[model samples]
Target: MRLLQKNKPVIRFLLTFFGSYLILAFLYNLYLNNASSQKYYPEFITHIVALQSQDLIEAFGYETKSIPSDYDPSMRIAVNGDYVVRIVEGCNAISVMVLFLAFILAFKKDWKSTLLYIFAGLVIIYALNILRIALLTIAIYEYPEYTDLLHTTLFPAFIYGVVFILWFIWIRNFRPKTSPKDV
Candidate 1:
């Protein structure tokens, strides 16, 4: 009880922050899921994937095709004429949320650090996500057996690890110092 009382401000801040995020996420998901039969999410993800594909095709030596189907709600990318890559929208959201949380946790008490961290984090995440999609597209073309493992384990770990490293850098270089007396 005493500990809770002592940490009341911290607890309040956390509760308010998380509560607002959850409410907003829920509302957004609800709007995307129910507002239309097309499910704003899949198309939005497809657009992002298409843009990534265009960049990859321009930068790398790969060609991609878009197939329209009602079979699954995922972005499909074909590479080199034969291989197919299916990227689900949920996975993209998960990766993005991980990056967002990393920035939030890293810059919790400082607005300046928070703004810079968020901008850097978003750029990193966007670039990484494009690379991730491109790699997965290539992987599906080369090794089908490794697709599940890479998608389920390797990619998430790699991206999150990068975010963690960035958070550490932000803390070491940017976080404001507080004296013991302040605590």
Candidate 2:
């Protein structure tokens, strides 16, 4: 009891963090599973990514089109029409968003600030993901030999790296502060 009382704040923080994270993760899994039952990929996000990818590719002067894969409607992408790179639900970044949300919530700040930061962060993540997909589509089109390296290494690193930076910023600048006495 003495030990617990001494570390009450830390204990409370951990409980809140892990509890919220698990709940959110479970909810996201439920959403994904439900969507999967209906389609191979979540239509909403994947479709948008496909469309955006196509637009980016076209803007770059590459002939591109986004279409449902012959294998599944849920699977789609902007392709050169020959080397098709399907954008599935996993590529949509919703899971990553959920994780980011969980971390932000765990180290909470003022309600208004928290909400605004979350919104801004989400927007940045989504836009970066779109850019990542666009670049990846071009890379795959131009260098099929580096497909595995691009998809598995470079792009994931970019998104997760950005996410790590965002988390660092949140902790450094946005997380609630404590007085020297409190520490």
Candidate 3:
């Protein structure tokens, strides 16, 4: 009981974070189920991400195209007519955003500021995600031998690193009004 009391704040934070994550993930899964029923492969957001990434690749002087994958609910992205990668629903990064949101909400502040921060953070994350996919597509196209390294290790590390940075920024600079010292 004494130890629990000493760790009350940490316990509360864990509960809030886990609870929020579970609820948001459940809701997002419901959305995926509904949205994926449409004709578009990989659902709406991922399809849009693929298209936007394709546009970015085209801008970089590479011929790029995306087609709905028949093998799975994904978009097969091809660079210069060679299929390089598939933009799956996981590539959309909504789940990562949801995880970010749960953290932010766990350290809840004023609603106005919290909502605005959430919106801005989501946009930053979404835009960065698009850019990440675009670059990854190009990288895989150019370095077919390093596909596993780029896809499985490097890119995932890079994106998750960015998220960790964002989380660090939030906690260090924009921490909630928990104590008198907190900003």
Candidate 4:
């Protein structure tokens, strides 16, 4: 009892951090592992690529085939018969890192005040990822030469930058207050 009282704040902070981290990590990993292992994500990406390529070809009167394939996980653009476009599934690491940071920042010092902040940050991250994937796909198809720029530099920076801004706002405005006794 003495030990618990003496270290109450530290213990509370640690428990909150570990608990939130475990849950967030588990769910994130489970989603990625399940989505990647199953045919749903791959097929969905393939269909989107194929349909978009077909539309572009039809609109532009081009004769190129761009049937989607998992030949390269980074990025790839190909021609089939009457389609041309790029497909990409990169930036998984960037997204995970953003979420992890948000989890850490929102829960490390105080879990209660920042719970909603963390949730909003996570939702923003998820939505941004989908947009990133779509933008990269279109970029690859439109300008294959700029694939490296889109995949390696632009998208990662944009996504992570947004996460950092959100975290900063949370820390500035919503962080828990500590009394002198608590400190």
Candidate 5:
């Protein structure tokens, strides 16, 4: 009893974090499952991501086209008529956003601030993901030999690194709103 009481804050935080994560993850899964049934659903988010990434690639004077993949339910982003990178549902970044949201909610601050932070962080993450995909496309196009390293390692690391930094910022700034004197 004493031990639990001593660690009440930590326990509460862990429970809240996991509880919210499960709920959000379940809801996201439900959305995906339902979406999978619709003919146009698969292209909805991933296609948009592909289009945005294509736009970024083209901005640098590279010819690119984002189209639906005939082989799979993914968006095929073709660059320079040779290099193609498929953007699947998993590449849309929704799962990572959900994790970020769960953590931010678990350590929520004032309502207005929390909402604003979530919105801003989500925008940053989404934009960064687009950039990551674009960069990966360019790298693969330029050096086909390093496709595995770029896709499997560097890109994932970039997204996770951004998430880690965002989590650190949230934890530092919005730390439960407890009073300094409470310590």
Candidate 6:
């Protein structure tokens, strides 16, 4: 009882964070589940990301294209006529965005600031993810030897690291400065 009392704020924080995370995750899962029935090249958001990445890759003078895979559920991303990567649901980075939103909400300050920050953070994550994919696609095309390291290690770390930094920035700079006096 004493420990529980002592940790009430922490407990509340944990509950809020995990609860929001689960709810967002569940909704995203529901979306993916419904989308799984579609015959689209990529699911909705993934398709958008793939297209944007394709544009970026093309801008850099690579003959990049994002096309639907007949044999795979993912969007096949080809660079210079070679399939370099598959833009799958996981590549969309929605899950990471969910986590970022949850953490920000857990330490929520003002609704206006919080919502704006969440929106901005989501955009940052999404844009960076597209850039990451574009760069990764080019990297894989140019350096096939580092595919495993780049895919499984470097890129994932880069995205997750961005989220971690966002979380830290929220806690250090944006979260409520003091505990509330009254409920």
Top-lDDT structure, candidate number: 6
Task: Let me know the TM-score candidate 1 reaches against the reference structure.
Answer: 0.77
Off by over 4 Å in 2: 36-42
What tens-digit string does per-residue lDDT give for candidate 3 at 1-183? 978887787887899999999999999999988887455666888889889989999999999989999899899989999999999999988999999899988877778877888898899889889889999999988888998999999988878887888888788877764675321
Alpha-carbon local distance difference test for all models = 0.65, 0.81, 0.87, 0.57, 0.86, 0.89
List, residue by residue over 1-183, the lDDT tens digit for candidate 2. 988987776887788778877898898777765654334234666777778877887888888876666676555554556755888877888778888887888788899999999999999999999889889988987898999999999999999998999999999998899877656
Off by over 4 Å in 5: 37-41, 177-183
Report the error of model 6 at residue 167, Å: 0.9
Instruction: For candidate 5, write residues 1-183 as lDDT tens digits.
Output: 978887777787789789989999998888877666234536467767888999999998899987777788887888888747988989999999999988888788788888999999999999999999999999999999999999999999999999999999988877676666434
lDDT tens readout by residue for model 6, 1-183: 978887887898999999999999999999988776354555788888889999999988999878887887788899988999999889999999999999999889999989999999999999999999999999999999999999999999999999999888888898877756523
Tell me model 5's lDDT, rounded to 2 decimals: 0.86
lDDT (10s digit) by residue, model 1, range 1-183:
989987765676577657656765776677557543354436565556555654675467777764534577765566767637666665464445544654465347677667767777777876777787777677767788897897888877777777777778766877667577535
lDDT of 5 at 29: 86
Q: Per-candidate RMSD vs. true structure?
A: 3.3, 2.4, 2.1, 6.1, 1.9, 2.2
Candidate 1 lDDT for residue 178: 58
Please list the residue runs of candidate 6 whose C-alpha ends up more than 4 Å from where it truly belongs after superposition: 37-39, 179-183
Task: Give candidate 1 regions above 4 Å deviation.
Answer: 8-13, 34-41, 98-106
* Prediction-by-prediction clash tally: 0, 0, 0, 5, 0, 0
Model 2 is weakest, by summed lDDT over 10 consecutive residues, at 33-42
Q: Give the candidate order by descending lDDT.
A: 6, 3, 5, 2, 1, 4
Candidate 2 versus the native: TM-score?
0.87
Question: Can you tell me which runs of candidate 4 are displaced by over 4 Å?
Answer: 1-19, 31-39, 43-113, 180-183
Question: For model 5, which pairs clash?
Answer: none
